[model samples]
Target: MRKIILLLLLSAFISGCSSLSKSQIETVQQFGEVTSNFSAYPSAIMEELAEIRLKRGLYYASTLTDPMRHLDELDSIYSQKKYDYKVSEKIDVTFRVLDKYAQSLVLLSSGDYTANLQNNAAEFGVGMDSLVNLYNVKSNAEKLPAGIGEALGKIVGFSGDRYIKVKQSEKIKEYVTKADTLVLIMTSNLLEYLESSNLEELISYEEKMIRRNYLTYLQLTDTGTFESQREYLDLKSNLDAAKDLKALTIQSTKDLQAAHKELVQVVQKKQKLHSTIKELRVFYQQVAEIRETLNALKKDK
Candidate 1:
């Protein structure tokens, strides 16, 4: 249905228009690509990071010679996800906001000016909807900050192409910049928390390993005193080493988290994102306001 509408609309707008012009193919295509880039919730990322962190601690504990050495060997494993986090953070704000800008033009071009209009539940694309859910916007009454959903809705009602004149006015520039800043801040915070969570979890894993080792030794068979005594000494030594490693990991985690206190506050509270998102939904509200501001600017021009 969307493709049909676009095809019909394209007949009028496809000629003599710059490819990347506001409502042209390039803008829509770019938006589609960017929209597809949305992946992983912040909470999910942190959870996985926590798990991997614990897993590494266990792996390290298994290597009695040097735990950090085993962790160092996991460089390849950790780097892959690290790259993803970096790429996700580098979202094309210029294109994303322009996508929103172009969508507004499409709506305005067709005389569809109702705020937050939607053709169907699926119109906003998975990217925007995931964002909507991530932000915990339960209903339409819960206005999204920064006009994100509304901006998406504005575009959704206009699949048919028209020779829409889209321009980047000053307010639009501010809107784009603000949106990009929010994305950067959001991604950075998530990645930072992931880093910290991984470190913190390692400490936890080490503590558990220490306790489990102690219990296992307690249940050991009553072999000769020599064998039993040596096993007990080795267990105690391993426990001491684990405790030291845990202390170091804890200090490192705390230090890193403290350095990014503001971002931490944005991404989490009590190991979850529900409360953080509720508080941070204000940023979405700010985004929506920018969309309105951009509209007013377009009108003024």
Candidate 2:
């Protein structure tokens, strides 16, 4: 009878130790999904910018008096553009590493703790360092804070250690507290890059150039040819699509930041995530709209 009572007590303790509620698990899973999807936006946006530049160059080359004579200069331009895209790819990879870290949090909630998850977390830290180095070497903008990379690595690595030592509910609260800072840094840097860089400027400039290009042609030919008008409308449509996408991407980033903060509060304070989950849903819808815009642009191309 003493053995039976002891066994019952042990079972209750085990259950109590592992009591990550189903709702909490679902919340972490949704956070992982939304963040991972959002992380890919930078790469997609960079590709879209590259496409716009390529089209603008081709159209301008067609109008040149001697396009063949400037082939060497155009080649140089293409090479530089390719290099820019490479930098963007590194940025994309870094964001993905953060996404991976978020997934690790989900793993904790699901109680599927991996023995080697720390290695994956360490890799993400290394990726963050590499990203900062690439940006510092290639960009003239103010360098990112020197400690930001190391700090992210440490937080992520520590979170892995805590996951193994702590109960799921406690680990999540601690992880979210540390990870909220990383999320802020990443999302802020991305939004800053979009706002301060020439990418958005280029898109706006292209819109103006398109208007002028069509207007000039219309003036030269008293009757605006069907081919010219149709081409003008198509080019205008592309620019409008890009602008719309940029707006949505910026808003989505903002929503992502808010969602992460709310998640931290929900986890730490043991609050329901009704509004936090709703915000994530809105973010997902924005991401879907961004995808649809990109697909439409591709079809137009």
> How many steric clashes between backbone atoms does each model show?
11, 0
Q: Which runs in model 2 stand beyond 4 Å of their true positions?
A: 1-18, 65-70, 83-97, 106-166, 211-231, 269-276
Candidate 2: Cα lDDT at 91:
56
lDDT of 2 by residue, 85-123 (tens): 764543554575466656655554554445455455445
For residue 191, model 1's alpha carbon misses the true position, in angstroms, by 3.3
Error of 2 at 243 (Å): 1.1
Q: What local lDDT score does residue 94 receive in model 1, on the 0 to 100 scale?
A: 23
Model 1 agreement with the true structure over 1-301: per-residue lDDT tens digits: 9989976677655554432323222222333232222222222223333433444334333443456674665664466446433423222332243244334323322323233433421254334535534443333233334544443333333333333222112222223333443344444443444356654564466456645644443444223356545544444444344434333333332332232233333312223222323322333333334334334433422
Q: What is each predicted model's overall lDDT from 0 to 1?
A: 0.37, 0.63
Q: RMSD for each model, in Å, please? A: 18.6, 5.9
Model 1 RMSD vs true structure: 18.6
